[model samples]
Target: MESSKSASDEGTETASKVEVKQDEFSYLEREFTSELFKLEINNLGIFGIGDFKKMLKSLEIDAAKVKTPHKRDCAFICLKSKEALDEAIKKLTGYVWKGKTLSVKIARPNADPYIKRKNEEQQEDSNKKVKRTVESQTVPLAHLTYDQQLEEKDKEMRKVLTAFGNNLRKLNPSFKLRKDEIPCEFEKIKPSPKIDDYRNKSEFAIGRNSNNEIVVGFRVGSYSDGSVEVGEIAKLPHIPSKVKEAVLKFQDFVRQSKFLPFNPEFNSGHFRQLMVRYSEFSKEIMLVPGMYSNNLTEDDVTELKQSLKDFYSDGEGNLVDVDSLYYQHLGKRETGEMFNPVDHLCGKTHITDVIHGLSFRVSPLAFFQVNTAGAEVLYQSIIDLSEPKENTTVLDICCGTGTIGLCFAKYCKNVVGVEIIPDAIEDAKFNAEQNKINNCKFHVGNSDDYIQSMVKEVVYGTLKKEDLDLVAILDPPRSGLHKKSISAVRSALDLKKIIYVACNPKAAERNWLDLCKPESKTYKGDPFRPKKAIAVDMFPHTSHTELVMLLER
Candidate 1:
């Protein structure tokens, strides 16, 4: 009887091991067969999770789960069956959803641990390659012959220009290059005048460096790895020396003080970010100190304010003269409110900068071009490309501080500048008044809303569309214009020319594509074709270059 019981126990153990093995095999198979699709929805304007689900439902796409990893513009859908996934892709790909193009493709199987490991290894290898390339380029060309160095530099410049042209072509295949009214095989690349110290503003974060010492500088790498490097401002050529000195002094003061550097992981400490803005025209400096107000007493605030005043005062350790100083209370919330409840700590409340003979009042939070010299070149190009006539009315969308529109106000009949930031609009108005410019009108609102209202006014006969030759200038943020803005532009019948100034070519390429696409449901009117485009080297020593394209029907 005992022998029989032992045999039964051994049999039970063997069955349990077999069951575990079978479950493991089943999981592996499931990973291999996971039906997931990724959709790169272009011009996904203000789309939330509910909107995405509704769109999927309208298309009869059955998604088990939906994930928006990055921005609301892209979505990942997990379908129950491969057939459903393929059908969804077929129906949505190349289709205009929300007036934007959709790109659908099968997502890589991420359920498999092996696949994740392989991807991580591949990323590390790519990073190593980039590091090696950068290191190789850092070797001074002074060792080579002068002529050889010149040849190498020219070769590198040509390579960059060619790559830029190729990317633009890929983004818009229908776009043709023009050289003196003749179609050219290659687009032109313009060089910037000043390369070093081009940036007018620099923001530094307070953190513990690799040496485990509290420092105020730009972050080098991922914060999770705790690989912050200190005193990097000295190496950056774009940052002015005066700004760097101020940052260094501030770093020292903060380190010596009782206040600690803010740790994002632990959410402790007081110091957050230090912003320095320098004016090339006025030669003035503006300092903005961002700090968290949570867990701070009245005495703590007073002490902090006194410390800042003492640091900037004419004392033994005074690094640079701060023309303006502002204290901003940064909250932990992710809202549109930037620098809530700002207080003027010392000196002036704003700085001044001159662009194309017009002085602009720049608030601490107002959006102004960091590259002051490059901005002059950019504005000149825009004016030349726009060709504003005496009777022409210019519509400047996303006009920060009304610099571009004010420049054109002297040449054009009327200039309407629209900006979303209220402070920027205020600055614009102040600039207009200071400059005694009456032809320009600055509006504080969203570009889309203002554009729609203008279209309505024209339709209602309140504003005669033909009375003034309308020329629209768009200088949107890095994300480019929303689909609604594009639609509003199309709806305007009297818009003769469009001058699109884009800092980020990749994002702007989509807008260009949409504008140039053949007449469809989203775009009912005749499509605008790119007449001329010039690359402005606003940011030198970097791969980024601003492209200004002129489009007309």
Candidate 2:
């Protein structure tokens, strides 16, 4: 009986250990969120490699490669087999692998049983080291008053302004930049008044309060042609006048100081504004009224009541209230998960000379340039390279708000735009009608669908080309060309030139290969091949870069 009891206790202990091991940690130990994982995966697949087929396509990498190995939780999964890892990668990349042989090298963090060995050696080294005979006292540089700092900053700003102005003017005689043209951590710079749209807006400024040490604000705008305009500067009446004056002086000082010679390493916000002041400035600018305001109207109240009543009072009944209906409609317009209205007012778009001559409003979902000047450069590049003329009938695929097609419409005899987003198509139609551009027409449907049906019909002669030469411009989503889109474009036998504007190089690269591949048929002539490529810095800060690849048959 004693021996049987001992055996039972041993079995229980073993089971408990196994359970602890299984529950303690996750199989996939990745630190990044699944959303970010998907983004990185999608970004990588955007740029396809031509040399490799689907199997090798899985090896493509993106900016996510910078992630630390330690952050990879999946590494700890103890995958059932190497095949499992390959399968996961294949699914993530949207590729297939039919290779026969697979080889993997395993790296061990610690090979030998040498625990505490380094600790013993470190102890011996600590004993050998002794304290120095003398210790030096810490000392800070001369303390500066607010006035002194402001004066010094102004002097520096003037010097930098002179240099920048000279260099810019030398490059282009028409070049000019305003105070707001340059931005910093404290305040933002905007288009100067010299530009017609921003002439009335005020200059932007930021500084700290003297008494309680809070941030103050001002607005500034600048034009590329070197015009600066100041807008109505508002300050909360609660702060002291002295602090207000100090803050204003500091802003000017900072602006002027920017022009002066300074090391990038030594540059920091602390030298000008207090850290707390900077934080307050950021909060003031970034915090939206939508986050805190509860300004509900009577109509909103009525709608809320009606909605509740309809939801609970009846199995199926409708309540009709005009005010409630209006409020509901407004609410739907203002907010939704899939569509963001805020982005329409302020979003990333490249506005170039190609678009400057044309008038249009970008759709909330459509892609455009955030920097108007930079966009001019990009558009001009496209125009110069594309050479869209009177004889050409340009087909702008994924046209968005018809910016590209409309721009070419004036020069080309006719322009046909196809886009996926209905709102975008509406905006494009409105833009064309508003601009009195009768030559361009926009259609609302998925570009892939439009190409498959409409383009196929046109190529087959059921629909008319109306012109001899076809010049195509495709600015697709980050995913590049869909299979259907590729087939449709290729079928356009009349198409002589294709301009592919890709925001993501990886995805576009893949689509480019698909177009040039032998499997792609020629409806009118030979296969399409890349003629030349140009890189544009549409997004300056991040790893992202835009590519324009010209393809000719």
Candidate 3:
């Protein structure tokens, strides 16, 4: 007998046919990269990434990497040069496979799709007789009043939630979602208390501005939009003046420093990115400057760090009023967790903040909501939705910094939080002690990997109670929990309730479907019924918002 392969082994192996994605070229001014080309094999829907790689190898093409934008019909071959791309297309075109005459053609790549968009925007602007600047490109809604922005965001969220409910209905049609049987309605979206300058975190890219000078700020557009030019975010409505000041101060320092800003195309230079975390509660700011040493020596790295320290402490960098300074070494991976160990150079190691009268230490890896004031509102909404009583035990899943669990612990009998990141669990544990909260018990591991056992522990083991009830408070990242975690929650009839706090509710609809779907052999326990739903406008002047929903048996 052989063991079955886990989901991680195959890398995004799914049963769905043709995972369609929005055209990346729709955005104006994206990163410029022509080194790689895509080959859209019309009949390759049956093939996986492994098959694509093997097929390329069989063709005797020396490509560096093969990736798909989750499209089964397309394969992106990352080659060294134009000659290599031409060679790959030349070899693979019109190749026969699996009783089909394969017609492989050049396809749209995510890297460079902006030339047309830029031209169109330019043409549109010329026709309208209006000139658009980088500020417009970065934050288009910045010109709108705060109230107007909130109204626009609410409209966007209404559209998003409608699509979200449709996904739920499509997945499990047997169970009526948002119909009479399933009670669900979108409450009024709460506005951020502090509309302007509400962003607590900003990751500024170190790149050249229009003047081609080394600058520290946000990109004019997203990378997928083929944008590489970093622009000043000083006028961005969401960015705090203090954070903007820090960006300008760093820009000046980088301009004068001997080191150069990191180039994504060339992959050279030392200074890469600057991450700022400002805590409204603590009135403290943590600065983490990112750099790569691919072109530097140990002595060079030490010299750069020392210069940064001196600049912030006594030089012009002091204008931003730096409270904490840290350094992060860069890694090669382009996306997903792109950071090495963060070294604390000086001042506070963490940005301490209080929510719901409880203090939490936000570490470099720990996740926190960008809007501090809105987080309080969101937490309160979740509490109000769940209505945790004295005999309740809250199982906080993916509890970062233990804010959500700790927030509930004060009302519930006890809260048991499980998080994969050790740093996050440590912060949760420390927060529990700091706030004199002893009911919280957090474990560090992949939530799905260990959640079943913990769920069993709470349901059939020590935490089980006759009078007490178990409710799961899921606040997973945008990429929701593994299906097994959803099944784990659904497997236990004793776990009666789920209060899901989603930054991206659209992504969480799948989990919601699994929880509410009729129980089968695969899904072993009784399903939960969808109840009240509330939306929080954590991000103002932006389309993003937070959602809190209650699900019970």
Q: For this target, which candidate reaches the highest lDDT against the unseen true structure?
A: 3
Top TM-score: which candidate number? 3
In model 2, state the lDDT of residue 253. Answer: 35
Question: Candidate 1 — worst ten consecutive residues by lDDT sum?
Answer: 18-27
Tens digit of lDDT per residue, candidate 2, span 1-553? 1132343344334324422212111212422222222222222222223322333344532221222133321221122344544554554443432322222223222211121232233446666844221011000111344234334433433343344334433433332434323211111111111121111111122322222122224212222211111222232322223333433443443333311111111121212111111011111111000100022345543443344334323412122110110111112233234442321111122111224666555432454543344455556667766887676667789888787777777677777888867777888888888788998878987777676454443456424456466678888889887766887777666676899887776556566655655532333235566565555544322234455667887
lDDT of 1 at 102: 81
TM-score-sorted candidate list, best first = 3, 1, 2
What's model 3's lDDT at 352? 91
**Who is ahead in lDDT, 1 or 3?**
3
User: Which regions of candidate 2 deviate over 4 angstroms?
Assistant: 1-354, 452-467, 520-525
lDDT of 1 at 460: 59
What are the runs in model 1 whose C-alpha is more than 4 Å off? Answer: 1-50, 53-66, 69-187, 223-231, 294-299, 314-319, 334-341, 455-466
Clashing pairs in 3: 30-225, 30-226, 30-227, 31-226, 31-227
User: lDDT by residue for model 3 over 199-236, one digit each (tens)?
Assistant: 88989899876666667887776544435677777678
Backbone atom clashes (below 3 Å) for every candidate: 0, 43, 5
Taking the tens digit of each residue's C-alpha lDDT, what string does model 1 give over 222-340?
34332233334566655677787778877777767666666543345677888889887788888888886564677777888888777777543355777888887765545565436
Residue 361 lDDT in model 2?
Answer: 55
TM-score of each: 0.70, 0.41, 0.78
